[model samples]
Target: MGEELKLLGAWANPFSRRVEIALKIKGVEYEYLDGDIIHNKSALLLEYNPVHKKMPVLVHNGKPIAESLMILEYIDETWKDNPILPRDPYKRAMARFWAKFLDEKCVPALWKYCWSLGEEQENAYEEACGVLKILEGELEDKKFFGGNNLGFVDITANSVGLWIVVIQEAGGFNILTPDKFPRLCKWAEEFRSCPVVKENLPPRDRLYALFKARFEKISGSKDAELASRH
Candidate 1:
């Protein structure tokens, strides 16, 4: 019997995009279910991921795997032809460690910096920059986070490479600049230009419009709040 594979994802979500890129790299054939998570999440997404009800849920042979990083690890283990995680034991562990760091620390800081208001936003920017600096140092002499190839950590850092650029452009926030993070900027260019990633990314204009509208709403709300306070 053939293996059954399906991926629930949204076009605009970087987390889902990570899974899509990984699957493409491995040459895996799976049904792409547009969860439309921002507007209305699908029933399958809810069924598979009850706790989080989030996207990038990988359903394999009737089994559901939630969380983007976990799904990536699952894909790496299930498909041996094109390895995502490193082969060496220590290297594999380090790859997982860095991926965790990106998910737990970097992603939150970036999101907070982008969406927050006033002093909280300033603090988030500092925290996000600090984490990004750590990532920059981590990339010291390597072409990609996983070394030469777009491996585990590189896939995990998709938000840093792509989404942040779009977010900054849409929201008019200048945080991850070429001058401020030269190496990371270069890495972003390299990552985005890779054929697999380049072809699969959400249209820049679409993402820009989505974030721009959202940022404007937030700004309007903040302005109204401040006006009422006086």
Candidate 2:
């Protein structure tokens, strides 16, 4: 018998989806507890991740693991079947490096570019573009970041595959286009086409509507804050 596995996650969060995808790929059976993190976080979620108080906490047996990347690695280590990380030490290190880079640098820049206005938005767009160029160079002719398999870097870059398009629509901008980022564009298409990725992806319309509301709310708040300051 296997230990009880429970995943506390929210529907719209990409990080939550990332963990879910990993579990699905590894053929792990688990209970999913869905909740609204913005309006009301559940007691279980708070208890598991007291510091971050975030979603996508994986509870195995009685122990809890916080942070999406940490949870991902834990899942890969625990299951051993359909491995997410590479077997080679050097390849594994490279996978980890790219995943961390996407999390720390690219994702932030992309979000900032989508959420901010004026000069801040312009600067963020440039930074995101620079990061995309580097990623494009890395990808080259590879089918995926993990060669033929959907591995660590590919899973971590869930946002780049679909969310970016929804965000671009919501923000009324064009950052990821075929002409500028041909490799990324092709990769996104191929990544999303994968059964594990395609079937599990959040509904595009719902995601668009959610982000549209969020962008409006954020812009309104910023405008109000600026007016009050002046």
List the candidate 1 regions with Cα displacement exceeding 4 Å: none
Give the Å shift of residue 4 in candidate 1: 1.6
Task: Locate the minimum summed-lDDT window of 10 residues in model 2.
Answer: 37-46
Which segments of model 2 are wrong by more than 4 Å? 222-230
Model 1, 1-230: lDDT tens per residue? 79899988999989999999999999999998886867686677779999998888999999999999999999999899889899999999999999999999999999999998779898787899999999999999788988898899998999988899999999887999989999999999999999998988999899899999999999999999999999
| Per-prediction TM-score to the true structure, in the order listed | 0.96, 0.94
lDDT of each: 0.91, 0.91
Query: What are the C-alpha RMSDs, in order, of all predicted structures?
Result: 1.2, 1.6
Residue 36 of model 1: what lDDT?
86
lDDT of 1: 0.91
lDDT of 2 at 85: 98
Show pairs that collide, candidate 2.
none
Q: Please report, as a residue range, the 10-residue window in candidate 1 with the lowest summed lDDT.
A: 35-44
